[model samples]
Target: MGPGRIAGVVTVPELAEGDRLTVDGVDLRVRVSARRRRFALTIEPDATVTLHVPDGRPAPDAEEFVRAHRTWLVTKRAIRERTRPVNPAKRLVEGEVFRYLGRTYRLTVADDVPSAGRVRLVAGRLVMSRRAAADPARGREALVDWYSRVGYAWSVGRLQPWAARMSAAEPALEVRDLGGRWGTYEPGTGDRGVGLMCLGWPLFQLPMRLVDYVIAHELAHVRIPGHRGDFWRLLRRALPEYVACRAELDELGRRLWMGEIWWGG
Candidate 1:
């Protein structure tokens, strides 16, 4: 229910939310969820390991689960190490390149005008006001905002067809920064009857096909809440080529610009 730190292997009556422990030299954060029917292990985007345990599960059970999956944990971590993001920082300078839907657009800093603080795509270039470009923080904000606005608009048109194929209702969608995740689906609640989908703004940089994969993946979650076999089977039925798209997304995603800025001397 709460956060606690666990060191080494020690038997405890129950595992609390956020409880941390090290097993086989690998650190894991415990997350006790009522929705979980059994133990599951997730390798997070940051390469941190999470042990998802059902509520009321004992600490020793968690340890045993991790030990059981030691091989998987090691292999996944190795894959992550090989595929870690090598995204480069961007400079808000003349002719700097940015991407949208797999197309490249050079940055063109414009003179400070009434609309100079905004970023826009004009004539195959990303134009920004000199005032915003001069400040890295402002420039980053403007670009991220542009991505969110454009991404939301693009995803709105794409949601329905995928939803129809998956037999899921098209839910309320938004685009924003989701840190380490590409997209997420939250089941609908009483006040909000339709489920909600959020796609990270950074995800807009990928090609349309990969974007569709992410959309289909999230839509599948509307029917199946977890990434279990059932979920994958459902997704595979809708998009037979999902495996290739997933691999491509993982590869290309590592190279996308993540709003990091470098002001060269």
Candidate 2:
């Protein structure tokens, strides 16, 4: 790796012939792609190396750029190695591991609800007591319902205070499906009232702080209508480290937030 490298792998798209660069302490493989529209760099997961170039650029120039970025490439490779992907399949089984509020919970299927329902404990696991005829789809719905009720009750209790602090008329809250977005707000309250998406199962897996962050964000929009600095200021006042919560919410959205249980007006 060289001295002036930002990522483990550096890409140079516009290189001419006779250009050469070297690395001092890193091993890298370079591949030149025939098609390149612009200069870009990508670090692979395992720290493997590849260099791409436009048709007009010379191969030598590309090699030099790769050599110049050797140091950065090495560091990025290390980061990618540490961050592993969470498996969604783990939640599909009974007595399996799952996460909620930054804590772990195991799945426990209880077929005897006494009133057709399901439940999960912070540590014990999911308790599913449904009919024998219930299939995976029904089981999932029953489980999701349990999550939705818990999320809704928690949001109203913990999040309403933030809205109350704004000293504005409390906007009428509505519940509905919002696909990827956890919740949303509209100016009018008739057909377009604030729509709160069902958090489903995955949302429970995140830290409570992240859930508070999302609720505050959507509730704030009911008053501000846009993502201006004031909106951010309001959010920060309610959640000092909202940025982290936002990142968590983004991760949750990408992996979870399936479109089901559309419950809006």
Q: lDDT for each of the candidates?
A: 0.90, 0.55
Q: Which candidate is the best by lDDT?
A: 1
Instruction: Give lDDT tens digits, candidate 1, residues 1-265.
Output: 3335568554457888988978879999888888779998888766788898999988777889899999999999888888888888999999999999988889999895457667898889989999999999999999999999999999999999999999999999999999878999988878778999999999999999999999999999999988889999999999999999999998899888888999869
Query: What local lDDT score does residue 79 receive in model 1, on the 0 to 100 scale?
Result: 84
Runs off by more than 4 Å, candidate 2: 1-87, 90-92, 120-123, 130-134, 174-176, 190-201, 252-265
Residue-pair clashes, model 1: 1
lDDT of 2: 0.55
Q: Write the per-residue lDDT of candidate 2 for residues 1-265, one digit (tens) a residue.
A: 2333347865434443333334354433443334345434555423444444455664455556666776777677676456423333323445655555666666666555565555555345766654511455565666556666666666667656877875434455543444334565645545665543233345655778877776677777766655679999887887789898787665554444342322222
Give each model a TM-score. Answer: 0.90, 0.54
The local lDDT score (0 to 100) that residue 224 gets in candidate 1 is: 95
TM accuracy, model 1:
0.90
Candidate 1: list runs displaced more than 4 Å. Answer: 1-13
Q: Compare the candidates by TM-score and give the number of the best one.
A: 1
